[model samples]
Target chain A: MWLDILDRGYRPGTKLLFALIRLLSGQPLPDAAKVVFYRPDFYGTRAKEFTHEAMRGPSAWSVGDRELMAAYVSQVNECAFCVGAHTATARQACHDASRVAAVLTDLDSAPIEEPLRATLRMLGRLTREGKAGAEDMRQVLAAGASPEQVKDALAVCAAFNVTNRLADAFGFERLTPQGYEAGARHLLKRGYR
Target chain B: MTGGHLPPVANKTEGIVPDEDDKQAAFRALADRVLNGEGQASARQRAGAFRNHGLAPPLAALIGKVADRPAQVTREDLAAARASGCTEDQLFELVICAAVGHSARLYEAGLSALAEATGEGSPGHVA
Candidate 1:
C-alpha cells in the first residue's frame, strides 16, 4: 500500500496541492502543471525560490540533517504530507537506517547532534505548549549551530507545520506507506524536500 | 463533521459537484487528525464545514495518527536553507511567521522548542 503511492500519478487537485507545497515552501504557483493545489494565496508567492531550492542541494547544515529535521518535526506535528515527503527524502539519504527508524518510531532517539536537537526539541515544545522559551535558540547556537542554522531549522519546523496541517486538513491524495518511503528517497536522491 | 461543504472561503464560480462520500470520509479523517495530532481550529472548521455541507472524506482519513514528538536527527534541511542565503533574522522571521502565522499550535511548539533548547541554563542539554 505504501509503495504503490510512489507510482501513482497526479491529478488536478493533487497538482494544486503540489503547487501549494511549492508556493508555501517558497515556490510560486506561477509554475504551471499539476503541482499547484496549494495556491500562492495561502502560502504566498515570496516562498517560491526557497521552496524550489529545497527540492535539491546541499544543506547549510547538511542535506541529510535537514531531511531528518523535517521528518522529525513533521512527525511531531503529525503532518502526513510532511512525514511522507521528509521520510521519502530521509530514506534516500540513507544516513542510518537504525537512526531513521529511531526518529520515526521514537523521536527521543533522533540521530542528529546537539544544537539541532535543542532547536527541534524547542520546536516540539512550542508545538505542544504554544510558546518556546527565549533560551532554546541560544542553546542551539551554543551547541555550534549558527543563528542562521537555528533560524532555518525554524523554517523547517514552521513550513512543516503549515504543510502538515494543509495535508492533514485535506486528508486526500495520500501516499501509501511504501510510497512514503520511496518519496523520501526520491527527494534525497534529488536533494530536495 | 459533515462530509462536503461549498467552502466558506470559496465562491460557486469554479469547482465540482463534490463526491459526498469522499468529502465526508476526508472530513472525518481530518477531524481525527486534529483531535489525535495537532489541535487547530481551522481544521475543525474544515471538518465542521464538511459536516455542514456534506462533502466526502479524503484518503488521509484512513491512516492512524502519527506520534506528536521526535528525539532523533537524520537530515540537513536547515543547513540547506542557510546555504540558500537566509540570515539568522530572515530565518527567524521566516520560521516564526511561517509556523505561528500559519498554524497557532505549531507556532507555539516551534517557539517553545527554540526557547527550551537555546534558552539559558540549557547548555549541552540538547546534545
Candidate 2:
C-alpha cells in the first residue's frame, strides 16, 4: 500500500513467483508476501526460514496454537493483515473456529487450557511490553507446559513479533475473509519455503 | 596441553557444541550485518534517534513509529524518507531489520527467563 513495488515493478523471479501464487490460489498475492518477495535472497529467505521453524516445525504445540499465537500478536500490534491471515489459519487448523474468535475476544477466558492461555498471556505481554521475565515462564510451567513447548511457543511469539511489524511498516493490504481462508490453505499446504 | 585448570572463559559458547553455538552466532552475525552493514542508507546517523539499534535516521524513525505507534506514521514521514533518498528496497530491508531486532530482544528475554526459572545448570538454561 505504501510502496509501489508490486508485481509490475518486482524482479523477474518475484514476478514469476507471484504468477505461480496467483495461478495456484486464484487470487493476487497479498502485500505481506510481496514485501518478502521484494527481497528474495537475504531478508526474505531468512524470514521464511524463521516462519517455517517457528510456526510449522515439529513441536508439542499444535499448528493451531502457533497460528493463534501469531494472530494474537498481530491483533495486539493492530496489524489487520496478519490478524486476518493467521486467524484464518488458526481456524483451519483447529476443530472449532469459534475458539479462534474466543481467543481474539478474550484470551484469558477463551475455552482453552490454562497452559495455552498462560502462554498466550505471556506473548500478549511480550508484544505490548517487549519483555517477558522469569515469572512469566514459571507461570506457563505451573500451568503444565513443558520447556520444549514453552520454547516453541516463544519462538512463534517472537517470529510474529517480527512479522507483525513488517506487515504494518510496509502497509500490507487487508484481505477478505475468503481470501484469508485461501491464503491459510496455501500456507498449510505449501508452507513458507 | 597440560592437565590443568582451564583459563577463565570469556565467550559464552566455550562449553556448548560448536554446531549449536555456531548457529546462534551466525544468526547474530547476520542480524548485525543487516542493521550495521554499509548500504545506501548506511551513512545516516542511527544511534539514539528512536531507541533502535544502528538504523538510519529516517528508517529508525519510521520503524520505531511503526513498532510503537503505527497510526502516527503519516504520509509526511514517508515523503521525508523518500525525499531523503532511501529506495523502496532499502526501506523494506530496514523494516525487516528493525522487526527482527525487536523479535530478538523478546526472544532473548524469554530465553533468559526460562534459564532463570530452570536454574543455571539446567538443560533449558542457555537456549
Candidate 3:
C-alpha cells in the first residue's frame, strides 16, 4: 500500500476485530475493508451507507447487473482489485461467469441485451471522460431503459467511480480467484454494509 | 428581480426527486457528509478537494491526479503530499473528497442527461 498508516493504523478494537475476521475466514481482510475500517466516521460510514443502498436497495436493476456495472466501471478506471472483486461477485450473482467475462472482454460482441449494453456505454463514457451528454442518455432510453433505470445505473456508476479511484490510490492488492470468490460470497451474504 | 431575465435561465427544477428514492436520499446525505461534515481535515481542505481547486501544490496535484487518472497515482505522490505536512487521516479524507467530488460530477451529468432525454426540466417543454 502507498500509505503505511492506512495499512496498519487500526484502533485496538478494530485490530482485534480484524484478527478475528482473519482467523475465521482463513484470509486477511481485503485492503478495501481495511481502508473503510481505518476511519469509519470520517468517510467510511457514509460511503458504506451509500454503497449499500446503491447496490442492494430497491431498484429496477438486478444485483448482478449492478455488480457488473461496478466491475465495468472499475475496468474503465483500470482498478484491478475492484475489477477482480466485483467480477467475482457479478459472476456469483448472475450465475453466468462466461457471459460476465464476455461482456468485459467486448461489450459489442458480448451478447448482452441492448439496454444493458447501452447503459454500459454511458457508464464507460462517464467514467473515462467524467461526463455523458444528453445523447448518451437518449441512447440508453432508446435501447429500452427507463428513466428510473438510468438513475439506478448512475448510482452504481457513482459508487464504483469513487471506489475505483480509492482502490487505485491506496494500491489495494489484487486477490486470488479463490480469494475473490470468498469475498464475493461474503459480499452477497452481508451486502455492502 | 432586476436583470434576472437577462441572465441565463437556471435549470432550477432539474434533478431527480431526492425524497422519492431512499437510495438517492442516502447518496445525497453521503455527499453532504463527505464534503461538509466534520472530519480530520479542515473544512477548507475538504472543500478544495471537492471543488478541485484552491489547494496547496502537493495536495492539488495529488487530488487532481486521483480524481482524473487514479491509475497514474504513485507512492511518490502520496509521499510528496505527506511531506507537505498532512497527516494520514487528513490525506485519507482529501482522497475521499476528490473521488466523491468526481463521482458527484458524473452523477450530476447523468441526471442532467436523463432530464434532457425525458424533457422533465427542459425549458418550454410541454407536459
Q: Which candidate has the highest TM-score of all? A: 3
Question: How high is the lDDT of residue B35 in model 3?
Answer: 65
User: Cα miss at B30, model 2 (Å)?
Assistant: 5.6
i-RMS values of the candidates, in order? 14.0, 2.8, 1.1
> Fraction of true inter-chain Cα contacts (below 8 Å) kept per model?
0.27, 0.51, 0.82
Against the true two-chain complex, what DockQ does each candidate achieve?
0.12, 0.40, 0.67
Per-residue lDDT tens digits for candidate 2, residues B1-127, read 1101111111222454322222233344435445555444442432122236555667567777865765466656766777888776666565566666666666667766776676642443233
Clashing pairs in 3: none
lDDT of 2 by residue, A1-193 (tens): 7777543567777688889978888888888777666645546666677677777777888888888888998898887889999989999988678999999998877999898899889888887897877798899899999877877777787777777776676667888888898999988887876
lDDT of 3 by residue, A1-193 (tens): 7788787888999999999998998888998888888778777887889899999998888999999999999999989999999999999999999989998999999988889999999999988898777799989999999989998999999999889889988888888888899899999999999
lDDT of 1 by residue, A9-109 (tens): 34577667766755554432211112222233222332333343432322466766677777786777665656666766766675576766676786656
Candidate 3's clash total is: 0
Assess chain B of each prediction and give its TM-score.
Answer: 0.24, 0.54, 0.79
Docking level for model 3: medium
TM-score ranking, best first: 3, 2, 1
The most accurate candidate by lDDT is 3
Question: Top model by DockQ, which number?
Answer: 3
Better of 1 and 3 by DockQ: 3
User: Residues B1-127, candidate 3, lDDT per residue (tens digit)?
Assistant: 1111111111122344422366666666666776666788988888788768889899999999988989999889999999999988888889988888888778877877787777664554321
Docking class of 2: acceptable
- Minimal lDDT window, size 10, model 1 chain B: B58-67
TM-scores for all candidates?
0.49, 0.84, 0.91
lDDT of each residue in B1-127, candidate 1, tens digit only: 1112212222222344332222222222322333233222244333333223221232111111211222111113233444555443232223222222334334334434444554322333221
